[model samples]
Target: MRLSNKLSHALSCAALTLAATPALADTVWLKNGDRLTGTIKVFDGGKLVVETSYGGTIPVDWKQVKTLESDRELMVKQDEFTGERAKSLKAAEDGKVTLINGEAPKTVELASIEQIIKPKPILEDLVWKGNVDVGLDYKRAETDTDDYDVDFKTTARHGAWRHNAEGGYNRESQDEVTTTNNWNAEYALDRFLDEHWFWQGRVSYTRDHIEDVSSQRTIGTGPGYQFWDDELGAFSLATLVNQNDYEYKDGGSDNFYSLGLKWDYNRYLVGKTFELFSNGELGKPIGGDSEYELDAEAGLRYKVTDWASLNMKAEKNIVSGAKDGEIDETRYSVGFGVGW
Candidate 1:
């Protein structure tokens, strides 16, 4: 009896190990009654890229796919014309996926599918993307002149939360006299409620000796909407209520409140080799001595490689209720930088 029990226990352990192992194959059924088993790499431009053991890599039109079965969870979205509905789903063997709603499993068709992306770990999902640009010039003459400018931006996303940080500095000197020197930094965090709606909080600080401003700081929060977000272009708008603090070069300090409206837009053209973008904020005071403020930038970028680009940009900045000779400033810069 002891030997028989040992054999049964060993068999049960073996069965549990087999059940816990991940499946090694993914299957796709075609409309023409043909089936293929392999690993799906990605889906883009209405094409599904798959790697098979027999065939190296196959590009199948999204329309030709009848059904797909996989053991991994993936993100699925519908076509653009259909409101771009999206969900996270896990597939079973019989070409069906169970949605998060706990409803009965539903069959999905290829025609309605826009994208299928594999799941990533929480830490792996925090991907940062942006660029930097710098410009410098120097002239050695009777009186020496030097100018330097730098701009940097980065954004990261994980799940429904996104974070962005940006900063820039510019300075020029002639004959040991500072002609222009200014710098600014901003940070923002956004929480997404859906594909097109988000809530954001922002903080910014600026110091500009050229404009006679020692420092200006702001904190704000608001809701935003993505009007268009696709390969061709994107646009977003938001309104925020902000508290602003100011310190002047002449030894004065003040605080105020404002209603701020902001706009961000970008476009990619010519096979995505060229990009144009603009963003701006306008603020009107609510109950303080401050009047109105504006900050804006527009830029164009030309891609030179996968990681580098050439850029030209113009910026405008203004603040109300500043000390004498401190109101507004503008500058233009051209440089090259890298991004992901």
Candidate 2:
């Protein structure tokens, strides 16, 4: 009896292990009758992402998918409806899925499916994400040039409010002669009114060690639109009327009113291993010596791991009507950084 009890306990343990494993629980069927087994990550832009143990993360063509099923609870959106919460999904007739919602199960055609995603839990109310990058160069033979650049950007969101801040420092010298020295910082606050619209208030300050311009300050506020924010990417645009103040080293100063446009955009591709982004603000002065100004950056990040990435960027700063003349500078940098 003792031996029989031990054998029964071993068999029970094996069954429990198999049940706990993620193997082949989620499924996708194609029009050709071929089927794939994996956990569904997301369905966006005509591609269905699935995470498989053997194949890693794979993107399947949405058009060729006949039906799909998953034991995971998900929110499915279709037509003009907000969305539907389902305890699970079951493959139904060809090109359809049955969403098991308690006692009432609903069938939806694959064509009518607009989006499929796991619902965000309330615990995600306070979330933070950001990254830092640096660039350094030195030369010993040609006049002993030394260059340094560092920049950081971060975003925090709580409920309907979002905060963004970015700052950078740059200095270059050749043979103890300072050619460039400047640092700038900016902060912006966004109060989302709804899913798409928001109000933004921002302020920025800059200090320069150059001969002509010594400092700059700006304050602005306006309305904006968030086109989308999701696992794939995010994009937003805003227009602001700004109050600007500038001071030069020779005790010269100027203040002006300006209108500016700002845009922030980013996109992730290929299972989130690659990212493309561009963000900037451009403005035209109304009643001052400055004509137009621009500050922008565009970049690409190749993720080497979840927290580390290799990056390349091009940054541009142009002040068309500075007291000294048109001030234009462009820089290219390659660096590695960590993000979360």
Candidate 3:
């Protein structure tokens, strides 16, 4: 009888512990006398985005949060401080935070915290996210006309390494005459050397009918610097040594060396509903008679839903080495895109 009673007590205690686990989930306490219990996705743009069981996702202003507690590890960032991977952070009295990162217990004021990111689980740690946009049109007035455009982007991050790729194609035909035909693709890989320094390698291929070029290929690698990385914007600059190869329409080919500079920036506004981005690349020949080349784009995107957006973009491609009549090409387009 005694043995049976002991076994029954042990099983009862186990059941109660399992049932109480979820009740002790992460929590956020607001200064306005509100308490939210859910998973905090990230803190950015002065707001905290949380995923809840009953309310989906909610954005709460950071200033309104008085305390936070989580059982999972988080990537924490502060002004001028590198990101710290921490776990078991809990709120204490007097607007303080407590966590064990590596050393002994550490405490900090709530206001000094800039951002907190949930650690990605193994299944989603390296998931890719990006967008694709396509535009098409046809006309049958006096003459048949067809136009098509496609743009693609994708990126993934793992540990200190990041990878990005983008490409696009455009075509226009009027009465069986090809008015425009162009396509370009690029891929870049980056490894963060430190908080503000990184190394990158990139390769690109282009074919421009207007420039009288059958194909252009470039391969480059160099160091880069991150000037700023925050909720409002991120700006980066890089310089590289490029090997350029160009094939002309008249069965001519040229290979040369060039120095390339790249600039990329992004901005978000209106609670992440509106976004503006621009990236440009410039290549100046170092030897073998290759003129300067410039490729750039500026775009504004408005989110219509979680996965859908309306995008307006302007692009320019210039090759000073091109034939006299085909030196510059500019385009503007609007389209719908899906993002993951």
Please estimate how well model 2 matches the true structure, expressed as its whole-model Cα lDDT: 0.85
Candidate 1, 1-340: lDDT as tens digits: 9999999999999999999995677777776888888887556456676777787557676677766766555556564222221243444334344444235555565565655655455553344567888878788999998889898887776657878798999899999899888889999888878767889899999887865668889999999887854434568888899998888787788787889998878776664578898988999888776578899999999988757999998998877664343477787888888877
In model 2, what lDDT does residue 298 have? 97
Measured against the true structure, the TM-scores of the candidates, in listed sequence, are 0.68, 0.74, 0.75
Ordered list by lDDT, greatest first: 2, 3, 1
Give the C-alpha miss distance for residue 17 in model 2, angstroms: 7.4
Model 1: clashing residue pairs?
none
Best by the TM-score measure: 3
User: Which lDDT tens digits does candidate 2 get at residues 59-93?
Assistant: 78889999999999887877322678789999998
Return whichever of 2 and 3 wins on lDDT. Answer: 2
For candidate 2, the 10 contiguous residues with the lowest summed lDDT are 119-128
Which 10 residues in a row give candidate 1 its minimum summed lDDT? Answer: 79-88
Clashes (N, CA, C under 3 Å) per candidate: 0, 0, 0
Q: Give lDDT tens digits, candidate 3, residues 268-322.
A: 6775678798988988988655478899988998889878989889888877854
- Prediction 1 TM-score vs. true: 0.68
